[model samples]
Target: MSEKIFSYLEVHAVDHCNNNCRWCNNHSPFCPEREYAAGEYIPWMEKLEKKGIEYDMISVMGGEPFLHKNLTGFVLELRRRFPRKSLAISTNGFWLGEEQIESYQMLWKLTDILFISLYPNLLRGLKDGGDVTPLLHKITKHNPHLKIDLRQKQTFRMIAYSEEPVEPNTFCGTSECTTLLADGRLARCGLGGYAGYSPNVGEAFRSSKHMFFDLNRKFSKGEFWNWRRRWPFDACYHCDSYKWRETNWKAEKGKRRRLDLELEHDRLAGGRLMALGNFTQAESLFRRTAEKYPLDAALCNDLAVCVSHREPLEALAYLAKALEIDPDHDDARANLRRLRHVLGRGTENARPEVCSADAGVR
Candidate 1:
């Protein structure tokens, strides 16, 4: 047996979404771009097949995979391409109906797991308004062999640009994910696809007509293992998704220590620069520290003061950013109100220059 164990393949078949959920991390409701091409899907599958690289599970997700014009055809192709592999799809479960359930018969025959997203507010009382209950009942009635994985819709807050937290036990980390984008990029994780930060799988497979023999060669060798291992953990650490749930109980204190070290580094660096009267550098360091440690109101207040001395007009902007990061920053709030008064006075009289010149002397 080959010691090599490959992870699940996550394919983003469509970029468009219909529901505008409040807690969506990827900003799916606001997503305006559609990059998936129906014609290129089969060829991409074929390329993966040619590689000895067989996926343990193929996951189809998007704004909603059901929204794809050729969803039935796509599911069929996935079945045909990966005969032995299990198929899974994540959906908001909005478009499922009696006819849709009938269409799913083909998928039920081939699919092993059906991961349905239950949006409580969207499907609260309506019997047929995208509720997975009807579909689950129908699917169970038809195919007892299929395993159903019903997941509750959880809030994913974007703490940073790259990371967001899913519910506990939901995230399996990068080791268990192989994400496929419509543009022929293969990501190490499903989140990477939504974040537009995945690695390139191969040359763009344009259509199903062309045989992607070369593309197959690229995916066959598992070079992505090394790539995934090198992915920055700092980006994720600052993410709201890196919550207490994801922390390993054994390594909790250690992880907290590391995070504290990172925060301390930023704090010390910012403080040293501020003491030296280098407001610009200090401001940059403090901004990073604020993002990582949003609970630190002192950092926010201090950073606000540094920016206020240089750019009084930007004082409000920095203060606002600080409060957004740390709402309980009383010092920041008080300083912000005071600075606004100074700004008003400056506008009426003369624009106040930053004290960078006299800062060094002080």
Candidate 2:
């Protein structure tokens, strides 16, 4: 890669992971089973070299790097080509076994750092029945020189696509990700990279070869590295972020979690408008979101807040529905008490509280 391109770049050994994590930004679980040949990256790297791009590190990661058919050979070639480049390999030991010890040793000897993600499922005797946990400890025992970065992933960043109106210029925290996916496409980040692969994301932004940056273009370092135009095909409206629902870390197994993702995206969008005192737009958004995701109590609570001003009775019905769905809904409960007090005082026009997403935008 060119010095002008970036300091970091990631090359996946494969895109299809054994664990289908829902919060995965890369959308690994959604992708088909395929191993990336080291040869595919040669021209991409050479293009960067031609453009004078140099990077500080080249991270080798995967669905699981060990799943790659040509594991040792792949990194061996990368090490040969860029001997000075720092190589880091990220893996979950699900695919690793006693049989692959020699290959693991060779890999440990070759790479600078080994990142092991100790997901709860892996620790709780999942899949391989606690075989992987012990082998992870052995990495340092044998390869004393290799660095081990262990990550205890209890929480993950949520990546969701909105079915709502597009916002055009949304710059995400993930835009800084500079990884090349298994399809030989170098993307600004994994979220944009898995355009055609991710369940909801594919539907939101249809993937095309053109969306993937043209490596053949005679673009300068700044032109090559410009993230805005390249990511999400000009407008980043289809994607947005908000409060993540805290759920247990388990595999979605490539299941579509679109409804909840869209719920949060649309609800949060309405919440933002509610914060700006744009109750009209917020009301419209919340009602539309409710039609899409009717059973969610949070949406009901949020919807109640917006409609409270013009339709106190409708707001009461919405809040009642939220409470009926989830009796422990604190915001709905709190809004109900406040709404009742206003009615008892005969000041029904008084805006109660925009509780829930906006935390009662008064």
Q: After superposition, how far is residue 15 of candidate 2 from its true place, in Å?
A: 1.8
Candidate 2 segments whose C-alpha is farther than 4 A from its true place:
1-5, 96-99, 126-134, 165-171, 181-184, 202-204, 207-211, 228-235, 241-246, 253-362
User: Per-residue lDDT for 1-362 in model 1, tens only?
Assistant: 23334657677666655555433433354455464654566576555555445557777777666666556577777777667777877876654444335545555776677777666544553365545676678877767888888766554333223223223332435424666655565554444445532121112211211111234335434553444444333233323343423211121111112234335435555555565566776676566556545435466566667878777655655555556556666676677768877766433223233323123211
Model 2, range 1-362, lDDT digits (tens) per residue? 43444666788888776666776766777877777877778668766766777787888876667666556689998888888889888886543333234334556678788887866755563336554556655666667777877776766666567655465454465655577754446776666676667666735445333345656556667766564235445324555643344566767753642345335546655665676677777777666556646457788889778888787777777776777678789898888778777668335334343335343322
| Candidate 2 C-alpha error for residue 53, in Å | 1.2
- Cα lDDT, model 1, residue 113: 77
Highest lDDT among the candidates is held by which one?
2
TM-score of each: 0.51, 0.60
For every candidate, C-alpha RMSD to the true structure in Å: 20.2, 22.0
State the lDDT at 85 in candidate 1: 70
